[model samples]
Target: MSLRTKFMLALLFTGLAAVAMVGGLAYAGMTKKVDSLRRERAAEHFHASVTAYLAQYGSWEANRGKQGFDAFMRSRGPLAGDRPPPPDDERRPPPPGAGRPEPRGEPPYHFILADQEYRVLLGAGVYKHGELLPEAARKNAQAVEVNGRVVAYVSPEGVITPSRQELQYLAAMRDALWFGVAGAAVLALVLGVLLSRGLGRTLGHLTGAVRAMHGGSLLQRVPVESKDEVAELAAAFNAMSEKLARTHEELNASHQTILTQAEQMRELSVRDALTKLHNRRHFDEQACTLFSHAVRHKRPLSMVIGDIDFFKKINDQFSHATGDAVLRQVGEILRSHMRLSDLVARYGGEEFVIAFPETELPQAAALCDKLRAMIEAFPWHQVHPELKVTMSMGVYADLAAGTAEAMLQKADALLYRAKETGRNRVCFAA
Candidate 1:
């Protein structure tokens, strides 16, 4: 079950058990006390009736019979079957103890009656008429007095019969008990709802926070609305979440720093130190991939090898610093003119290599010729009085050469032929 439901049920059962225990005990104790009081009042009233009867008649001689007061009791009691007809104006006087209301049923407790001489007058289904009351039984008998003279005695315990008044009181007490139960139940339900809702609200916030953290948001806050244990737990959870988020951020920053350093190291490994272009190692790897792609897709591919003409002589005639300037300028020019798809790298000292994907021999050779002319027209006289500079490039575009290494070798042969044929020119495999 949900947390709210479990909490509500726990409260509801607790309230009910408490109310039931207390209410049931109260109702039972009240029932016992009420019965005791009813029985006592009945005994006292009966005693008073007997005393008045003797006072009017002056003896047991004038009762239902001189046979005994049992005669009078049998006459007025339940076994009489039917009551006598209404008295006429000339009717005889009413019988003894006839002043009581009609009995709805059996009396709550039957009684034993005796004269002042301790002679049993009524047995109450326990003793016979005119029997001397036992000494042991006489202890429980209450004296019936008339004008300060004891006339008879009455016993308080015998048959149990609930009269109308007793039943009415008991029923009222029962109703009150039921009402108490119902009220307690309703109170429990209301309390359960109220308390559980408050608790559920706190739990809902915790649940939502956890879910958000599960998603990409690592930081969250929840309300601390109370000082109860639940509130303390929420506070603890908030602390833990904040710490976790902070730890995650730290880990991410460290990871990013490591990745950046690794990337820089990788770049340095494959880059030429002086020219800032890809070195031969990086070029060979990319050239192999480009050659494979061109051969696999049956697409045009081109390879070119270019050399700075008379580069060693320039270094010998002037200083190598001037030659370094020329090489940097030429590498920059190649880098600036190349498309994103082209790969240009300094192959070795004063030499360069280029690979062009998706380019035919004609387009490759024309591009190489343009680069040669640009290098020839550069103002090299600034380096020395007679200084001059130029480049020779050989273009080879044919995947039939089978590998990037083989194609570059063919371009190198063409580059040699270009240097032999002319100093500042581009030669192609035409």
Candidate 2:
């Protein structure tokens, strides 16, 4: 297929995929919401029915008697029946404490009445009245109680199928989904064709510009009248053509100047602008090289991760300018304390990392402690009389540690431990 056709097909596919994903997620969320609403309503109904019944008869003990059971059966009518009703004993209610058999067989609703011990007193299921429900089924089931004690459960069996209103809602949603899919399909086709035509025209302009440039026309430029991606490309091409013409004119005089600018840009790329310290990118590059050398030579090497404590509080209480000043001071201290063989960098924010070559864990720990003490003792009166700054440090040193990444991670974890235990401390592991 042509490039335009392919691009159009890709756009169509992406649009359709997005629609399907959104529709599926929306449908799932709606389904969950509907199910939750149904359960909530069912629970409300169950509670109301139990409350009204108990109110009429007084307590569970009163309901356990023959009069109560008969009254309950009559109230529930044939729906609550599990077997032929026992012949009534009008002489006296079954001796007090004697239990009534639970109902059995499937009914429109399943209700169970159990005692304090969870033994079923009456149930509306096929199980025997006294049988225990499986633990899995009882999870999240609602309870009924008497005198501030749980005495029964009313579990509705089967999925609470959608009611008529919910079914209508689902049907409407399905219709909307179908309509959306149809609309998306048409939209995709129209957008695909338009984009293909536009891209084709833009690419044709680019091709002609390249041909003119190849024929030694350095001043040739692509017209850029819009802010679309194609226009951006055209603007970039025009700039390049202009640069080429200028370069051809001053190739001898500007060569050294260009090299100096390139070097400055490279330095800027790897240095933190605020603190004038080597940034994380530079740190990673240096760390990999140093770690490899240490490993190959079987020399001890230690890594340290440090963070300024209460740095955020300082920023909140003082201005951000003060925070930046503090960071610059900290960076100066770190750089001064480091030897030519060691590396230090502003990892990010108030955090910094240092790598020590030919040094063991104990030596690194000692150095970090010294640095922490120095930072703590620095006269913050220079900035604010009451200001106090401290740092937590963690060091890891193991020549056999397979990767630099592993050592860095260990040091980070140790730094977290130091922070958790108390601020302004140094912790180390070998």
Candidate 3:
């Protein structure tokens, strides 16, 4: 069942059990007490009457058998309900709520009168007249004394009929007990609903938040509506969720930073530090890919290796700073002049390499010669009056060279031939 229902049931059962046990015990004890009081009153009244009868008649011998005693008992009103009330002049009005007059019926209490020798004179239906009373009954007999001497003993032992007021009292207690049980049940239900609403609401919020977090939204909050342990639990859960969300955010930010740094590190690994050009290793790896594609498709691919003429002497004479500037400018020029499909990189000191896909040998030679002219024509006077720069380039276009590495070697050999021919020139084999 629901939490509220379960709580209500538990509380209700507990209340009912408590009320039942206590009420039952009280009723039983009160019943026993009332029965004892009734028997005491009956015994006292009977004892006095018996003592008066004996005192007036002088002894048990005055009344031989039950016939004389019955006559005496009839005069004295032996049965309470059997006699009419005494004349108004002689009788006082009974107290209110004490009880109504007893109905004419068998009396609940029976008294057996015994003399000092323990012979029964009045059995009240339990023994024959003049019979010896039982030992067990004799133990409970109360002494009836008249004029400072023991007269007789009477034992009052029988079912006790409760008075109307007594019945009313017991009934009132029983009704109150039932009322208390009902009241307890109502209180339990009310408390169950009130308590369960707060607890269930908080738990519902927590469940929803956990599901949302599982779905990738890491942030959540729940209400803390009480100071009880359940509320503390909710508060703890909220704190834990907040911490988890914060931790997840931090982790994501760290992950992004790591990715950015990794990209920068990878770019640095493949780039020439001075000119920011593709280094020989990156170029070589890419050139192999390009060569594979060209050979597979039987497409045009041109390879070129270029060297700055007398680069050592220029660095030696113009200072290495100027040589670096020259190299930076040349790399930028080549990068700008090439198609997006072309690959270019600084091969080593004062040397550059290029790969032109979808380009024939003649077109490659023309582009290289143009590069040579541009280098020779640049404003050398700006660096130093005596400084001059030129470049020699060699181009080769042949898939028969096998791997890109072998093709690059052929281009290098051609580059040596160009330098052998003269500085500031382009050479190719068609």
Candidate 4:
């Protein structure tokens, strides 16, 4: 069951138990009080009957055989609910001085009368007329006397039965107690339900906030609607959500910064600082990969290694800055003639390398010639009024130079041959 139901049940049970206990105790106490009062009344009646009998008859012997005892008993009211017993041996008269027997079953409460010698005369509560009283019963006997001589003893037995009013009072008390208990239980149940609902509503807000946060809404917050502990918890949760949101933003910013730095580091590692072309290390790595793929796939692959002709003369005659400008231009010319599948790198000072995938020796030689012409036609006079520049290139294609270093070395040898033959020309191995 839900907490609300459990709480209501608990309160109801407690109220019922308390009420039941109190009712039981109250009933017991009232029963005892009523019983005491009844016993006192029965004892009083016993004493009054004995005194009147003694005043009229003088003694049990004086009143015998004349119906004096029967007359006296009949004169008294009923002893509890017992009626007088039938005359003893009605067909025969009592011997000159005998008294009538007291009845049996005296309504659960009556008096027993006996002479001073403890010879019982009238029995009470199911006792025979002449039966000797037990010590337990005799213990409560009261002696009646005249002229300093004990005449008779009266013993009360079960004389504490409650009267009608007393019984009704006890019953009413029980009913009232039970009614109050039921009322208290109902009240407790109502109060418990109210308390549980109040708690449930407060906790619901926090629960909703938590669910939202689980769904990736880190900014979700609970509202503090009261000054109770639940409201305090909501306030704490909102604060925590805000902290989480801020932390998420800070982490995202840090991640972006790290990515930018990583990209810059990667570019610096592979690119030449001056010409902005792929450096020698990047060329070696890429060349090996392309060469292996081409050989394995039986595809055409070519290499063109070029050198700036009279590069040292340009630097010596004018300035190194002019030579650097010319080198930058050379990189631009190589890029212009290259496709996306080609790799171009500054191999070293005044030397450049280019690799072309899916290209034959003849096709590479034609591209290299184009590049040489472009460099020769560029306005090198911008750096110096008289400075001019050109490049010689060599092409090697479809050769099984197993490694990148081997392929580059073979192409460099071809470039040396082209420069020796003439400047500003392209040469290729068939």
| CA lDDT scores, all candidates in order | 0.83, 0.78, 0.83, 0.80
Candidate 3 lDDT by residue in tens digits, 1-430: 7665676678778877887888889888987897777778777766776787888887877877556655565566534433343454875556998787643323445578888888887777788878998999988988878788887888875445565566788899889878877887788778877777787788788889899999998878888988999889889988998999999999999999999999999999999998888999999999999999999999999999999999999888889999998999888888888888889999999899999999999999999998888888989888778888899988889889999998888888989999999868887885
Per-model TM-score, in order, reads: 0.68, 0.42, 0.64, 0.68
lDDT of 3 at 332: 84
Better of 3 and 4 by lDDT: 3
Where model 3 places Cα greater than 4 Å from the true spot, the runs are: 1-104, 109-171, 195-257, 288-303, 356-373, 394-402, 423-430
Candidate number that wins on lDDT, 2 or 3: 3
Winner on TM-score between 2 and 3 is 3
Candidate 4 wrong stretches, greater than 4 Å: 1-181, 295-298
- How many clashing pairs does model 2 include? 1
- Cα error, residue 312 of model 1, in Å, equals 3.7
Give the least accurate 10-residue stretch of model 2, judged by summed lDDT.
77-86
For model 4 the local lDDT of residue 101 reads 39
Candidate 1 to truth, TM:
0.68
Ranking by lDDT: 1, 3, 4, 2
Give a tens-digit lDDT track for model 2, residues 1-430: 7778888889888888888888878888898997777766655555555655665676556767435654664555332212333445533465668886454321223345555455665555445567886665476456776567565665654335455567788888888877887788889999998877878777777888889878977776777757898889988988998999888768745877888999999999999998888999999998999999998888889999999998999999987888998999999999998999999999999999999999988889999999999999999879987788999999999856678778989999999999999889998988
The residue-level lDDT of candidate 2 at 14 comes to 87
